[model samples]
Target chain A: MNPPLSRRDVLRRLGFVAGMWWAARAEARDIPGDSVYQLRAQLTDQDGRSFELSSLRGQAVLVSMFYSSCEQVCPMIFETIRLTLLALPVADRERVRVMMISFDPARDSVAVLKATAEAHQCDARWALLRAEDAEVRRIAAVLGVQYRRLASGEFNHSSAIELLDTEGRIAARTGTLGAADPGFVKAVRKALSRQA
Target chain B: MALEIVRRATRIVVCAAAACGTAMAADFITVPGGRFASVLPQGPVPTVSVPVEVAAFAMRATPVTAGEFLAFVRAHPEWQRGRAPAIFADRRYLVDWRSPVLLADGGAADRPVINVSWFAARAYCESERARLPTWLEWEYTAAADETRRDARADPQWRRRILSWYERPATTSPPRVGGAPNVFGVSDLHGVVWEWVDDFNALFIAGDSRVQGDPDTAKFCGAGALSVIDRDSYAVLMRIALLSSLSAADTTGSLGFRCVRPGGERP
Candidate 1:
């Protein structure tokens, strides 16, 4: 019978294995410790273009989660974003992008997302996105957005707009709706001005 | 010298094979799903109560052990303690482990793996072709005792479960196997707080919006969870704890299990 392996020997072997694995895989650039972009969630936009959430890096982004069917606060989220952007200078607003991900991917298809975008008059800078249920959950988790599907087919969700800095770090968040949150707008302006 | 080199190479190969071979051998017991009266309402209105329809699923009979997690990190090096991204896990993640791939001692292997972030737990489950159980599924399965499937109604049973919460924290918890519930699951309580797939979805009781409270204004749409059963203090405490955590946050007493779909409904 073979001799029993010691802890040192096992660790040595494991270290070698790990070393080989890391060597074989190309190391990606380091994202900030607090950056939400570290979450590699696959998302599809209103245009049906599939992209990773991290691809939105290099721009101050306003991110939120809402289902298109939500009549009350979901629409208000769009209006609030618009109002928040309006509060910023046009140049700063041009640099800032909005990412609205739907937690209800089952019903929020590409066509549905596009229509919602049109209804909200969302321009090219705004991305109305949908992801798989698990991905949606992870995105929500990272953004601190809470949402759950109800029996009535409507979603019971927290409406918080998170501001991701140029590096995708959460710089500011606001849950106020029906109008722009002044503090959140100030944070957005600060984020954009810093990036500028 | 040649013979010694050959033995070392042979040992490495054998050790690698053994670790990879046993990684996926966890025991999964089926918990039949049905209409469950969850503490958190399934409606937009916090006060209104509704039953959630949970599908049948298979769950790990016990929480993921440290030994099992060691094998997992060996297979998927990206999820190792130091290698995992900071956005996915906080500094306390897997802090108890002596090394990224080694448990502190032999006894550490059998103890339920704690200080694991929700993201890390979810990754481990994904590697096994399973996912973390939903809050509803976990609550439903945990409501069972050794004899009855829904022993939550009994005051003595509630007290017994609550006592686990009251006990002082043990730095070295015992091995995972305990009395199995009606679903053949063990250590759902008195072991560790677990990570649910929808942990972030659990809105807290304090999320109730007040007219002038700025912090309360942070949530839209009946975001607060109005507890339907206040008597289930143990279960309600679990909800509160889970609702308070972020995806990257990990605590010493928190661990998790995985669940697969298509379990036979009883």
Candidate 2:
């Protein structure tokens, strides 16, 4: 019952099939051995755009975890990361991106995340993401960030800035907060330079 | 001679069938949860035993065996020794195996699978639609003995568990057939060190004294958690071992089992 295929029709069908194949291949490439991209967690950014953690590949990332309700150390975390980025050269800064994941995902919805992003003066280069409670725990485990929720609706957590290379490998980590550690900044610069 | 040959063939067929049955069935026992006092104190005080309210759940009757893990890897190649990503497992993962997918000659199929990273164990549990028990759940279930539900308060019970820890780590572990505890669960102690979901949360602080320093900024909220019941050496030893490990780190004697939510069948 099928019609005889013309050359134009045949080429059109072949192109469509090839396009689909390419798309699937690109989506399913093998992740690197040392990359944290292997973790499967769904995240929604401050802009309410949903994405996987693996989608941040191909760009060096400065990652950390914090909660919106945290008044003392959390704000310092944002400031500390901001200063760390400022320490880098302008060109290198443009090459490196930043991601802040919330450990208190139940309270930090997209609207709250958007407000926090604005308060921190976060530009497009930065992403404030929220995930479910279990996914948050998994992300914290992968990053070696420790946290525990208290009875008072507050959280006690270890603060660290992890530098992830383009492939999502943790190249360097520093627990020094409230100020930028020069050595960590240098590592970030080196990771960015390596990407180029 | 023909009769002897037939008998040998029959024995082989029976053994193969039994192995197949075990591979298909992983026994799980229901644990009725309740208000339990844990050796680890909640909040900052060390004087009171933190009352933890645990919900009912089902736990594997025994630690996952080498045969089960091998079959799991065969079904999901991504978790095999060399094939798994380094971020999820260290180089020592399944190093004792004969190859990436095969067990060595002396590695018994029923022995608890060891040298597995937490991530690998978690993935295996996820494949079964289950998960590693939280530290509280494991601690609560482990507090029981064959006759009594809360045998942890008995000195003899504590001594028995501590004796297992005193044994040299170099010795080969026995098979996963330890006597069942009060909950009808086996191998909760005296077998292998199992991974809990919240191992990192156990010892987030290196020491309680460090909380006063500016470096304490590393930890938010109520600084580092201090020990409540310092006399529970067996539980403390477990916490120390777990605290020293990263998720990707594996050990020669470390293994894990899965737990399902209450009333869920597996």
Candidate 3:
């Protein structure tokens, strides 16, 4: 807003400005709960309750998004999670929780999530939670879940297993939704190791 | 007195042995493997209408060998070897053909072939003037074993199949089990899924009889009685299972055994 700065003044400020831009660009996503970290968002879930992204504060949360009706990738994803969990020694399984969030609010109700859970025969440790439309989208955006519905009422979404450490910052993510085998397993293992 | 006694004993023994052999042949198929249900598909045998004529001979034992399927593949060039179609792989690549078909101990030609497709198989059968045995014909043979105590039934069969499933992946050749059926068929199971004609012809809708049930209404339809010999608990599996995959499909699992028509069995 001021008159054009003198050549000396502009030159004098360039390094400082350049340094601040670099710092911002290279900023590490905060490991939440740290003083340097700030909670950026929150959402209300189906139970009329709210799940603050910050709630996954301390444990490594592997959040997976899926709808009950998926035919192609859901089963593989479920099995991958199963193998990953089973690959963990029983002791390690106790520390980790695989949170499966349902993305299709129109049809994926609580009952549907439970049915899907049963269909896969997942054990009690796996939590299948369904959120309302707004909450699903908001939380999905918060977690960077990329998803779109196909014409068949099925979803063509990224089958990514997102790793959030106890502090609730994204630790790592990998695997296309269609990976047939334990690609997600590799990602989860890498993330857990990173956390350690 | 010694010669008279020997002659008398020999006649008795010969008569008894012949009777035993006859009884055994009448009860040819062996149900050595699963406690799982057998299918009693009774649909129209478009190819072989005369039921129980043993229109097709069952495999003496399951075929979990590469040699067996290789014969089928070699005979049928039209069947795309690696990319067997989706209709064959259950709409997914469940069959990993490249994984391994050879057994740990090596090969057995007599073993039934696994990891083959209906398309490849149909060609093989056609070349020989024999087609894949319909589900009904297979059931007819299996029932003989079921009734005569010639076959191991129930709990034992279940264990046998499960055991095959648990075998090391590297141990490709399916182990042989279950005595041969009357027609000299071997290892019908405890190896891989056998192919049958008219698989999806009779669908098992959950509430088939109900208004909401699928069109055929459960396992009891016009086609139901045709496919099933009786409503045995295990038979439902064959009737209900829809494994009609296309030729381009390849699976680590799944294979087939060849059958010759009654008049055709060599």
Q: Give the best candidate by TM-score.
A: 2
Name every residue pair that clashes in candidate 2: none
Q: Candidate 3, after superposition: displacement of residue A62 in Å? A: 47
Residue runs of model 1 more than 4 Å from their true location after superposition: A1-27, A194-196, B1-24, B43-48, B207-217, B264-266
Per-model TM-score, in order, reads 0.86, 0.89, 0.36
Candidate order, lDDT descending: 2, 1, 3
lDDT of 3 by residue, A43-155 (tens): 33433345554454555666777778876566767876676677665756666766777778779766677678888986755667766553454455445454544334555
Sliding window of 10 residues with minimal summed lDDT for model 2 chain B: B41-50
Kindly list the per-residue Cα lDDT of model 1 for residues A24-129, writing each as its tens digit.
4532355776788778788899999997777777778999888888876788889999999998878787888999999789999999999999999999999999
lDDT of 3 by residue, B106-202 (tens): 4445344445545455545554444556565555545544334234355565554456556665435445556664545555544556666433233
Question: Taking chain A of candidate 2, what TM-score results?
Answer: 0.90
Interface alpha-carbon RMSD, every candidate: 2.5, 1.5, 19.7
Please give the ranking of all candidate structures by TM-score, highest first, separated by commas. 2, 1, 3
* lDDT by residue (tens digit), candidate 2, A20-43: 999878766666788889898899
Query: Per DockQ, what order, best first?
Result: 2, 1, 3
Q: What fraction of the native alpha-carbon contacts across the interface, defined at 8 angstroms, is recovered by model 3?
A: 0.00
Docking outcome class, model 2: medium
Name the TM-score of chain A in model 3: 0.65
| lDDT (C-alpha) at residue B54 in model 1 | 79
